[model samples]
Target: MKILFLSLVKVNSLSDRGIYTDLLREFVSQGHHVTAVTPVERRDSNSAKIEVEKGFTNLHVRTLNIQKTNFIEKGLGMLLIGRQFLRAINSNLSGEKFDVILYSTPPITLYSTVRKLKHSMNSHTYLLLKDIFPQNAIDMKMMKKDGILHKYFKSIERKLYNISDHIGCMSPANVNFIKEYHKYVSTDKIHVNPNSIEPIIQTISSKDRELIRADYELPLDKSILVYGGNLGIPQGIDFLIEILENVKLENVHYLIVGSGSEYQKLKNWCDQNKSDHVTLLKFLPKEKYDKLLSSCDIGLILLNKNFLIPNFPSRLLSYLEMGLPVLSATDPNTDIGDILEYNKCGKKVLAGDVISFKTALNELLSSSSKYQEYSNNAKKLLLQDYDVVNSVQIIVDRVEQVKFNQNV
Candidate 1:
């Protein structure tokens, strides 16, 4: 099958590991010809071009910087990105036809582009519902609910859903949210297709862990609780600071390694309350980050308590891949905490509940036997539920089913 994947993530090569790249690699391994259309943001100073590689082609469309920029630019960039992508596709791949059009939510501005391609190539469109928009924006208080911008994006969201032949949500909670709010969407079209990756299975030796921790100035004797991802508003940064301010455990340490809009805020707090227990660092490269993550004893996840949308962060896969038990402080709406508890891989507490968070942390840190059990369960859960092969198979099955229905 000829597959076209649309995403905001910049993928320079399939050799790099990430959820989207891993999924695309799986498609290539399954004998599918994949064309991934991705952005080359203005900050990168790259021109639009197409690179043909083994098993797939990557079309890089130049656009305004949509990530880690001011709100005006990000908003404008998303608004204009779809048109930019369509023009690039027509110019470079005019002769190409796609069997399946697979795209993920983020911008949600690809409605016109997807509609045009689906009609032109007679392709089946699949929506990888990673982030629910407008609502999330409202949740962050970035956009006012029922305001002009919200109403505008809401219409686009509906159009995007309407054009999609299938919508693959990240979890059961997401599927339920969509079903309840978007009653016009058919239930048959929605299914759980989680954030998956081709997990690299390896363990850092005790010596290596100690070395890595020493390199980062992290104490080897303490149980390191690491939060290694975007430090943005959606992550409930205030609550994380609260935990740091109040946590008095001598055997526990906090390691935060990421850069985002909220990085400065967290840095300011860390500066004011300088302590030996907490270490804050900027984002590291993937290889280095993974090594640092493996050196840590626990993985941390945080979400803003106000979110109505269930956001399943892809960072969970990284933590699980390393066999580190997760500790999530998230909004009540997301089921990430539920999954962690059900699999016995970790624990979760409501965001802003510092007491519960500390208690769970103590439980995970108190018993070595229980920690090992949770660690083992983490790896098992990754293999059974979050593997990229499963995601690839689910998409292929859905595409085939769509084909059969069209024929019937």
Candidate 2:
């Protein structure tokens, strides 16, 4: 099958280890031709280019920088990005026809493009619902519910959902949330197709872990709780810092390694506190980051307490792949914590509940046997459920079913 994958992220290689790249690689491995349309957001210039890679073709459309920048600029860029992307696709791949169209969210501006592709090529459209946007924006107080911008984006969101033949949500909570609030979307159309990856099971020797810890200035004697991902508003950085400030666990060290809009805020708090128990570092290269991750004892997941939208973080897969037990501090609405608890691989604390967060950390530190059990469970669950191969099969099966129904 000829598959067209569209996303806002710039994916240069299918060889790279990411949610999209891993999934697309599986499609290629299954004898399907996958072409991805991504953005190459530039600050100084505006241009688009296409690159032919080994397993797939990448069409990089130049647009305004929308990530890690000022909110106003990103907002304007997002507003115009859909039109820019549609033009780029029509210009370059006008002759190409795809059997299926797959895309993910953040821009939610691709409704027109997907509609055009689905109509022109007679293709089935699948939406990988990674985000629920305007609501999330409202949760973070970035946008107001009755505001003009909010209403406009909500319309785009609805159109995107309406055009999708199938929508794959991250978890059951997401499925429920979408089905309940988005009554316009059929519940049968939404299924749990989580953030999956082609697992790279790399084991770390004890001595190697020690060496890496020493090199990275990480404490060898302490049980390290590492949070390695975007440190933005949605993550509830203030709550993360609050937990950090209140955590009195002497044996458990905190290692935060990521950069985003809230990096400076966290950095300021770290500098002012001048505590040796916490280490705040900028994002590292994948190899080094993975090494550091393997050296940690526990993985930390954070979400804003005000969230009405449930977020399923992809970072959970990374921690599970490394056999590290997760400890998520998230909003009450998110079901990631529930999933973790059900898998018996982690514990969850409500976001902003510093006391619970600290108690959970202490409990994990107190019981080595419990830690080992959780770690093993995490790895086992990843192998059983979150593999990209399984996710790819699910997506392909859905597409085939959609096609069959269309024929019937």
Candidate 3:
């Protein structure tokens, strides 16, 4: 099977970041030929050209930057992206057939792009719902529900759902949301295929932990609480800082890893408010982040408490896979809340509530014995409910079913 995956995120073979590597390799290892396409950082007219990083012979990448100006970057980004993608697909399809056209939504307008490709190739199409748009933007106060942009985006979202051969949502609540919002869509077409973490193994380098601590100038005696990944609209940087202000104790240090546009905002806040127990580091290579996290006392997952729509962050699975207990602070209504409660991985705080977040942090940091108990339970849950490899086999199975149905 030749499967072409479309994503907005860069899945660099050089970086051990993001789920794309695991997802790509998983399909490739299953005896399917896989190719991926993503947008590159905006280029100047002086140096604008397509750059391809051929990691594997089967894995083909095409990079083009549509534009990089402040005005409507995302909306404009996809327009430029769509043009380049169609050109790539046409040239690459060169006498070969793509059995499945797989894509995920973000700019959401990609539906227009993918729909044409699906028709051109006459292939089965699947939507890997990584982010639920418009509503998520509303949750983050990025857009107004009654605004023209909202209605425009909603129309595109509906079209996207209508065209998918099967839509795999990252959380069960997301499935419910689709049914509620897009009531006309077929229920069976929407399935829960939650985000997962690929388990990692690091040789017990005694100093990897020590070097990480020293490089960050972190205290060796304090129990480390690491939050690795995007520090954007979802994570509630303001809420996070508030929690740190109230909860940073002598023996508890909050080590934040990863970067985003909001990274500097959080860093500036950190500097202004002298919180001794909080340390901020720019995004570390995943190998280092993963290794440091595995040895850390707890992992933190945050979603703005304002988001009522069900969301599941991939970070939860990563922490659980590392055998680290979580201090998850998010809306009580999310699917992650249920998982945290059911698995005893950690405590759930009200999304964006400083009091609840502080309490949860203190509870987790109260003792090593308490942390260990939660950590054990977290690992058990990972093995029992969230093993990515085993679960993703189910994903491939479903895609095969879509193929079979189309054939019939």
Top model by TM-score, which number? 1
Report the alpha-carbon TM-score of model 3 versus the true structure: 0.89
lDDT of candidates 1 onward, in order: 0.93, 0.89, 0.74
Kindly list the per-residue Cα lDDT of model 2 for residues 1-408, writing each as its tens digit: 889998888887788888899999999998988998888887746467788866588898888888877878887888778788889888998888898899998769878888988999989899999999889989999888879989998898999999998899988999999989999997778999999998888788999999999988998899889999999989989988887877858788999999988999999998998989899999998878888899999999999899999999999999999999899999899999898889999899999888888788777777889889999899998988899998889888998887788789
- Model 3, 128-195: lDDT tens digits are 88888889889888899879989998888889989998888877788988899779889988988767
lDDT of 1 by residue, 1-408 (tens): 999999999989998999999999999998999999999999996787899988899999999999988879998999999999999999999989999999998879999999999999999999999999989999999999999999999999999999999999999999999999999998899999999999888987899989998998889889889999999999989999899989779999899999998999999988887877899999999989998998988999999999999999999999999999999999999999999999999999999998998899999988999999999999999999999999999989998887898899
Q: Order the candidates by TM-score, highest first — what do you get?
A: 1, 2, 3
Q: 170, model 3: CA deviation in Å? A: 1.1
Which candidate do you rate higher for lDDT, 2 or 3?
2
> Which number leads on lDDT?
1
Q: Cα deviation in Å at residue 147, candidate 2?
A: 1.5
TM-score, candidate number 1: 0.99
Candidate 2 accuracy as TM-score: 0.97
**What is the number of backbone collisions in each predicted candidate, taken in the order shown?**
0, 0, 1
Instruction: Please list the residue runs of candidate 1 whose C-alpha ends up more than 4 Å from where it truly belongs after superposition.
Output: none
